[model samples]
Target: QKEVEQDPGPLSVPEGAIVSLNCTYSNSAFQYFMWYRQYSRKGPELLMYTYSSGNKEDGRFTAQVDKSSKYISLFIRDSQPSDSATYLCALELSGGGADGLTFGKGTHLIIQP
Candidate 1:
């Protein structure tokens, strides 16, 4: 099974709704988690990052990690049409050396106006 699993949700929601995205992983060695947002035809940019188990929030975005359950989540508050994009979850393994992050297949989201 893939180390990380995320629903590639073509999730649609009305504007101003709260949107939630999730990812789960089987690797206990992963200590860092990140969420990236990618707009159509553009590269992803990091939206949130957390180390180990905890919650981090920035503006309308929030990220949570649970090492015990090997699960992570991203919540977008007040969803907007400008928020339509692909969201990716990434993990950083312990002692990974120079290896880059392992990313989940992106979940596409659309916010209706």
Candidate 2:
């Protein structure tokens, strides 16, 4: 099984809608969880990350991590057409090593006007 599993969705939503993205992992060693946003033909950018099991919000985005359940989620509030992109969830071991990072399949989000 993949280290991280995400529904690579062309999840379409209207402008100003709420969007949700999710991922699950089987690795018990993973302690750091991250959400990445990727535009076509470009590298993914780190959207947010959390080490604790809780929700962290930044503006219109919220990242939630549940270590016990080995699950992570990203929420977009008042989503916009410009928000259309591929969203990826990533994980890393507690050691903080770069090589331990693993990514999900990515979910493609389309925000329609």
Q: For candidate 1, lDDT tens digit of each residue in 18-112?
A: 99999999989888899999998998999998886888999999999999999999999999999999999999985445558999998999999
What are the Cα lDDT values of the candidates? 0.93, 0.91
Clashing pairs in 1: none
Off by over 4 Å in 1: 95-97
Clashing pairs in model 2, backbone N/Cα/C closer than 3 A: none
